[model samples]
Target: MAGRIIQVYGLWVWVAFAFFIFVLFNQSHSPLPHSSGKPSTVKERMMRAEKAWETSVTLRHEMANKHPGYPRIPLFPAQTLEAFGKYPYTIWDFFPPVYTCPHDIQRVGRLGDGGKWVCGMSLYENRPALPASKAGKRTKPGTVIYSFGVNGDSSFEAEMLARVPSAEIFAYDYTVASLGPQIAGPDSSRAYFKQVQLDRMDVLDRTPPFMSLQTLMKNNSHTYIDILKIDIEGAEYYSFDSFMDWCDRENAGEMPIGQIMIELHLTDDENLNFNRLLKWWERLEKFGMRPTWLEVNLLAVTLNPNKADPRCVEYVLVNHKDRKNIMRQES
Candidate 1:
């Protein structure tokens, strides 16, 4: 009886051990959780979330850095605030400050009631002076002020010329928007002064009668240009060099120019970056011109540590001759 009892007890113990082993193996392989007493802390969860977010941001920044192109830098909030202060004025007003650019027979400090000034991508401000005479006299009927890239809009230039209506202004722009052939006439408001000259050539292309600046001046019999405004996109870097050469030839024995206004384009292109900008500074210095107004556009950020955007600031160069004249009229 005692032996039979021992055998049965041994069998029961082995069954119990086998059941425990089965449970342990099943728990290890099962996806569902066997609850543990302790729970995750709030601080731990927060730390994990923050770490994940930081990792993501770092990865994105790394990708951007490795990309083979210019990175876009957004304008700072300060720039927007500055832009607002110059309200009712174009982007050019924020630059070169108010009294920086030279004015010819025009008030420099006073703002017009509803008048628009000549505002360009680069720094230039055009304030109109009262007509040369009270009688609304016509000085030179055929006198023309030639601008290369008029595009479609002439409202700015037209308003400036209204102060000097005696001169017949000839603005040349090839890509001007076409309203219609009839709408192209000159009216009291600023419109194209004459028919659109559609010679599909760059200002440098030598295509005969319209090829060179010399030809244009000779054909028009224009001995002098009262106000020369040049804004030809990024091409101004090249065109201005050529134009200066022409000016040297014409002003050899004559007055160089009564007044000059130009919007110089600066870029990070091979021959037109910030270093080239310094070269421009040198050239303007030689011409007896100094920057009266400067407006920076902040076109792009450069990879080169020593370089920055060429158009970061637009400069308005004025002949030193006009500084006293401008200050006297304004003061």
Candidate 2:
């Protein structure tokens, strides 16, 4: 009887322990956290992760601000603001790395001075003098002044030239294939127009063929150009190269030009583009010219404020000696 009772108690204890273990296992394996039907902890986790990321970004920006030689915020020139206000572009997008100078003032000259103005022809009337009178000849009213790439329409070039009565204009454009009749007609005498390709590189190599500024100077027997305006669809790169080469030759006592007006195109990547621009500026400096005017454009679309177009600004360089003359005149 005692043995049977002990056996029965052992069986009961085993049954109770098994029941307890089963309950504990079920609690441990419950699907409350991961079930699709359960309340979402996932969204809460994601929100927390985003908050952490933003905090990290803020901390990094603060650290960068404290760091030496970090990129500084850029300023705009007064003329640029007046001409093109808050146009969605950042100067950081187009400016080259080494040319990272302040843009808030006239980089080429002091403000409120009668400096040689460059860009859209609004300020040309305020200049101290027009091109000097041609040597030995009495200044004639409305003498022919030939400009390239005017496309048969009167532009700032034509308007500014008109201010000087000694200029009868002849503007040329070869790229506009449809305007041959308008440019080459008998009715085009006061400002004769020609639809001729003025951007060809091969034409520069010819001796007396066509459209060589050197040849034109040779033909006219004139030493200096009064107002040579150039805005030839990024052709300024090669043209300026040639112009510098000519200047070098002139420094060696060969052909030389008087005044030059060129529109410079800069690249978009600040580091790469700035390096390239610095090389060009260094060359200009070697030839004794400095930046007199600069216009930076930030191409932005209405739908996207954060994004900007890459090709966005024009810089104007003039002779440093001329800049000094401007300063003297202003004083």
Model 1 agreement with the true structure over 1-331: per-residue lDDT tens digits: 9999999999999999999999999999989766876664433533443344345445534543443331431222124576445322322322222223323323221142111223121112333322434655434323345655555555445544444433445555545643223223343433234323323223444322123444456566666554455555665555556556665666552334434455555443566633355455446545645444453444334534665434434344444443222222321
Q: What is the lDDT of residue 183 in candidate 1?
A: 27
Off by over 4 Å in 2: 1-146, 168-170, 177-212, 251-260, 266-272, 297-306, 322-331
**Clashes, model 2:** 4
Runs in model 1 lying further than 4 Å from the true structure: 1-144, 177-210, 253-255, 297-314, 321-331
The lDDT for every candidate, in the order shown, is 0.44, 0.43
Give me candidate 2's TM-score against the actual structure: 0.45
- Give the candidate number with the greatest TM-score: 1
- The sequence of per-residue lDDT tens digits that candidate 2 reaches over residues 82-125 is 53453333333222222111121222212221122342232233
